[model samples]
Each structure stands twice: as structure tokens, then as C-alpha cells.
Target: MPILGEFREFIARGNVIDLAVGVIIGAAFNDIVKSLVDQVVMPPVGLLFSGIDFARLEWVLKPDNPATKANELVAIQYGAFLNTLIKFLIVSWVVFLLVKAVNVIRRRDAQHPEATSSAPPPQEALLMEIRDLLKAQAGREEPPTRH
Candidate 1:
């Protein structure tokens, strides 16, 4: 099909592959940010909050009936939400910093390359005019020689 050929062309262009790689790296980085939040950041936060362990912290929306532990699910996982929120913020900050740094370097490279080089001016019009004048002069000389 024409569509399949077009899709193949699109995939073969390398942009899709680059995007796939970026997604894979982003997923891996997410785990790193999660670890940083749970392991490093939350401990100090827990100490600040009178030694409350974030993981062990949760609020029960529906209290389980003392008589039965059946069908007693609850809601509002604030601690996990809080921890995840912190992780998101850290990841966003890191991504922002990375993008900012990349932009700065890109701007710098655009302004000043390793060795700045200038392009020569185009001389097509001038060359064409000179060529026409030479041909005209040759035509005039040939007529005089005939006379």
C-alpha cells in the first residue's frame, strides 16, 4: 500500500528511532528520580516531620470493620502522593536545568563556532553581464573584419 511505503520512509528517516531512544532513556531516568526522592530526600523530610516515615505514612479513607478484613479497601494515599509529587518536582527541575544548559550551549555555538568562517558573496549576475558584453564585443569585431 502507498501508506505503508510512506510509513516506511518516515521510519527510515531516523527521527522515530531517536524518539524511541529518548523514551527509553526517560523511563530509566524516572526510576533514578524515584530512588533519589525515596532514599535521599524523604529521610530528611521525615526527620523534619518528627521522624515520620513517608512510606509507612498513609490515611485510611474507609476504616476496616474490626469484625472483618474483607472488602475493606480505603482511599486517599496522601503520603505516597506526596512522595510521588516530590519525585515529579525533582525530575522536572532536573529536566528544566538540562534544557536550559543545552539551550545556553546551543546559543553559544551558534554565536561563535570553533573557527568562524564567512561565505563568499554570490557573483552570478555580475558574471552574466560580463559574459554578455564579451559576446557582443566579439560580434561587433567580426562584422568590422568582414567589411
Candidate 2:
């Protein structure tokens, strides 16, 4: 197939669309989680650690030159890293919970198959029932009788 045709085929798959939507929502969710970590979760934790702002908590590997302010300060921002780690944990926990819930629902649907829309149509179901009945009747040793 042509390259454009292949691209079209790829885009047409349901999984691709689902993945695109997931990525978009995940980005938005990431922002929310970041805000929660920055505004709500980190403040009390920082207060407990005696007024340390994680974003500003950095070690100056190379001090800035006060003479001319020519060379900028280079530092390792470990506090920001800690905040990011907390955000990662929160997001992971949420995703885990969502997956667990989906699995539970999936198991319930599997056990009660009719709970989902995967059941055959009424016409197909009736045909299957008739086929089974015919098979059972055919297995009998008795001859058929006309009513």
C-alpha cells in the first residue's frame, strides 16, 4: 500500500483514537496532579520541614559572580525533584485504581455475560436454541411421531 494509505489505515484503528484521547486527558490530568502537589500536598509537608519551598530549594554547585553578575548560578533542584516524584506517585496510584475498577467491572461482566452488549441478536439466539433442540432430539433412540 501507499504511505498515505497506510497512514489512513493506522488512523482508522480504534486503538489509535483511544490512545490519542488518553494522551490528551493524561496531559490535562498531569497538570491537575502538579497543581495538587504544588498547592495542597507540598505546603504542609514543607511547613513540617521548616518553611522549605521545594521549587526554590536548590544547591549552588557554582556560585554566581557578584563582581559583574556575569556567570549565572548552577544548582541542583532536589526539592523540585521530590515534588515531581510525589506527583508521579499520585498519578500512578490514580491509574492503578482506575485499572482495578475496570478489571472488576470486566470480571463482573464476564461472570454475567448478558450484562454487556456482547450477547447475540434475538434471531441468532433463537436459531441457536432450535439447533440445540434438534441435536438433542436427534440423539434420542425413539423414532419421530407426527402429531
What's model 1's TM-score?
0.70
Q: Model 2 shows how many backbone clashes?
A: 0
Which residue ranges in model 1 land beyond 4 Å of their true spot?
A: 1-3, 69-71, 114-147
Candidate 1 minimal-lDDT segment of 10 residues = 113-122
- Clashing residue pairs found in predicted model 2: none
For residues 1-147, write the lDDT of model 1, one tens digit per residue: 699999999888888999989999999999899889999999999999999988776777888777886978586778898898898899889999999999998898888986445543469767888899999988878454453
Backbone clashes in model 1: 0
Per TM-score, the best of the predicted structures is 2
Candidate 2's TM-score reads 0.75
